[model samples]
Target: MRINQPQLIDSTLREGEQTPSVAFTDQDKHKIIQGLCRIGVDEIELGIASPLNTYLPNLVKEAKKITAGSCRLSLWCRCKAEDIAFAATCFPDLLALSIPVSDPHIQERLGKDRDWISKTLTASLQQAWAAGIPAVSVGMEDASRADTDFLVATAKIAQQHGATRIRLADTVGICSPARMTRLVQTMKEAVSLPVAVHCHNDFGMATANSIAALEAGADSLDATVLGLGERAGNCRLEEVIGYLALVLGEQRYHPEFLPELCQLVAESAGRDIAENHPLVGSAIFTCESGLHQHGLTVNPDMYEPYAPERVGGTRRLRFGEKTGARAIQLQLHKAGLRLDEMQIKDLVHRIRSGGQVLNQEQLLRFAAKCC
Candidate 1:
């Protein structure tokens, strides 16, 4: 199947702040926005446009300056006339008005019915338009669990109400890739408006589901840096962009900017980037297993999906207890040192007995001393 090149909407400034104990200062937000723009994302969701968030207007202004109109800036708001009215004051390029479409959220949470959902959504879109908002999107919260028929109906209503886009959110991260594909396909067939997917990572399928949605013809995907958000967080910006650029061969995004961008977000969130984190981790391209090291020594492509430099990473081999004799010989040969088989075997035993991982320089020094 031909993969669609989808627009990326990075929501780090908005959804990422929902992470516990995370509050990005103005400087942090500006830096993140600049970083995101450098990566060439299509849009950025700044934050909620509530009156309490007094910095939103200025944030939007600064984002405009940073992006210089190359990227669109958006503000999120609830499905209320007041929220739409306030969000218009921020002068964002787009306003995303969100409401629940599932039975649980509509009936139990909001104490309302589907009819009220349609009414409120219609009113919200109209209000945003009346307030002179240039573009508007309607988000269906808990859409993964919503009835398929009702979801189609709601999307049609959103389209009829002049929404430029419709966002389907996996509110609790219950969707598998197959489910997300079906949902996006159905919505695409039902509405002419652009379809966007927002997936959560409670089940660790946000990135998978998001890719599935794009393959099924979603027009956009929502993501956050480092996957920072409530609970298990949202789809990771780096993971999605990396797959698009490296695997799908999409040239619109720059995955090489991910390392620095993710580092900035991790520091602001007071979170540590796991060494094995896909795409931008410090050690993702580092090898320790003896078998893998041998493959890398022969042809890095045998073990690596792509060159580490594709994402601004470097390939590194570490020697340890797991290192095989052939890998040690290969490393020693690269350093212009040769040893007899017996000597190499004895050195391997000693290194394994030591039970420590050694870098290239350390392994070379150790081999010189022992051999």
Candidate 2:
């Protein structure tokens, strides 16, 4: 499925931290919220609220204080009276309650019947409404694996109980892109509320599944920066933003600050940037192979789908076993120096021959020495 266009994009603050190993400190949270605002995200999920867990109230207090008016803040909760009431104290712009629609979670996780699940969700949603928070939504936890009739039945109940949206969580990350499309469309047709899709990356189809959900009538997505989340992760925020802007021709998000937002997330999550991760990965804009280097010299378009500048990156010439003289010359040119053919060849030969690894500072020092 293909997106017709993008409406709005949320950032990786709240859901991004859902990655088991990725936890953000209060300072990190402040930085991430500011960065998301800079990148023009319409919303940010702060965190989940549960008496079943501690720490959400203070996080909400800090998040609300940091973000600008342009970014709406949200919180997630379980579909229970206490959970809903616990979260409403924070006074978030939106409250999303996760309800188990499948027999497994309904029976196993909650130890309750389907009829009981419906009552729980409706009661929780009404509680949020009474608190003067205008927005309420329900997440169909493990919806992708659930029986269709049950999922739709749950969404209709949510809509009837003052929920303006329903989220389908591929909670276990087992959903395929096609299955995502079918399931999202099925629930979307069942209710008048907005539809949101949350996908995990277990099968490496999170982004594809998100786009497919949008194609099948989902109006919103749950994505994370650096694709940080439980297990493998959730839908990657930067990848989805790029695809929407470059491929789908939607400019709903601002691109000028993408790298800043990425950097903020990387620091907050305490994860080093992986070379091969899409979009925000350090190597995403770096060229190494001779052919790629040569083609990039002729036209960056030959090697890159979108200009690196759009994501706050400049083209990088990675000095390695595969680099050529053209790449060396380009790097030198950026340093306000020029190396003729023989000089360029020498640098490439040494780099390719495994003489030394070149970081930006090392290359700059070498260029200064030559001058």
Candidate 3:
């Protein structure tokens, strides 16, 4: 219920859209920004000014017009002068400069040695500072694969040069929670700079890794609404926010709106809400097992975590052929009919024998048949 550890939340509009097929229109992006600010995010990563920058300008222009001015807006970019040049046009509150710290990337992809990358990063940081921006953060493009000593040294250099925060980005999405915690601890011990996490979900551990990082000393996490990003995606905003509330019980922030945000991003990304998706999935709160249904009738807490009402999802009784007496009776009552235990039992037997999946119409028919 109480947490001494402080963590910053950067929301979905920016990093989330990196999902293979997700894109947010200006209106959609603005809506997310408004909600994220209301939800008390410490910072917002408004992913514009990419190599082919367009979203950043649109979001910044629109964001400047909106009134959710509580959180800082940060734009993500590669470690390039032109990207920084693009960022200066809007002069956002926080500018995040991303760089490749791994030797392989520095040698092959970046085509520059560590010395060059470090020098260029320092120059870029100074340029951002001179632009009169409030803060500049550094994001290591692939810290998971980067040499640990090299990563720490680079982070220290960035902090000395002017970066207030250093983000350990899981660029290839390859960090487990344990690795995340260890890396975060290493970074925390290495520099006075605030450490942040930008995890991708290629290995499906973005949220877990992010939580681990925060516990170990990360002050901020980069999350996209509904886990939308390039590979598997960054951590899902709703997932972590819910954990921070329900599991950690900080209660300072309400997490009920997470489902709404998930729907928005899912629509933007052209993905259906997977049935097993946490918290917001249609099946998360629905109970259908015969024995589980019997227990639920007495007290839903037997299996459910927080009540469905807590997250804006409804408690639902899914119809399954393996219906118990209490479950069958409950369904009969829900159907506005009263039936004896025998009638309900017989009905359950009939439904189970046919291997027939019941639809709404069929359920109604079964209810009426009991009449």
lDDT of each: 0.92, 0.77, 0.78
Q: Write the per-residue lDDT of candidate 2 for residues 5-38, one digit (tens) a residue.
A: 4444454656676666777777787787787776
Quote the positional error of residue 278 for candidate 2 in Å: 1.5
Between prediction 1 and prediction 2, the one with superior TM-score is: 1
Number of the top-ranking candidate, with lDDT as the measure: 1
Q: What would the per-residue lDDT of candidate 3 be over residues 1-371, giving only the tens digit for each residue? A: 23455566565766676556666787787787777765566677777665577556767867766634776777877667777878888768888888899988999986889899879888999888877767888989899999998898899889899898998988888899898989999999999988989888888899989888888878888887777777677787788878888788866556887777777767766889987799889778776677887777778889887888878887766665666567667656766778777777777777777676564356668768666
Report the C-alpha displacement of residue 283, candidate 1, in angstroms.
1.6
Score every model by TM-score.
0.97, 0.84, 0.89
Q: lDDT value for candidate 2? A: 0.77
Tell me which of candidates 2 and 3 scores higher on lDDT: 3
**Candidate 1, 1-371: lDDT as tens digits:** 56766899999989989899999999999999999988999999999989888899899989899999999999999987767778988999999889999999999998999999999888888888989999999999999999999999989988998999999999999999999998998998898899999999999999999999999999999999999999999999999999998888889899999999999999988999999999988899989888999889999989999999999999988998989999999989988999999999998998899979899999999999996
Whichever of 1 and 3 has more lDDT, that candidate is 1
Kindly report which residue stretches of model 3 are placed more than 4 angstroms away from their true locations once superposed: 1-8, 50-58, 329-344, 354-371
Best by TM-score: 1
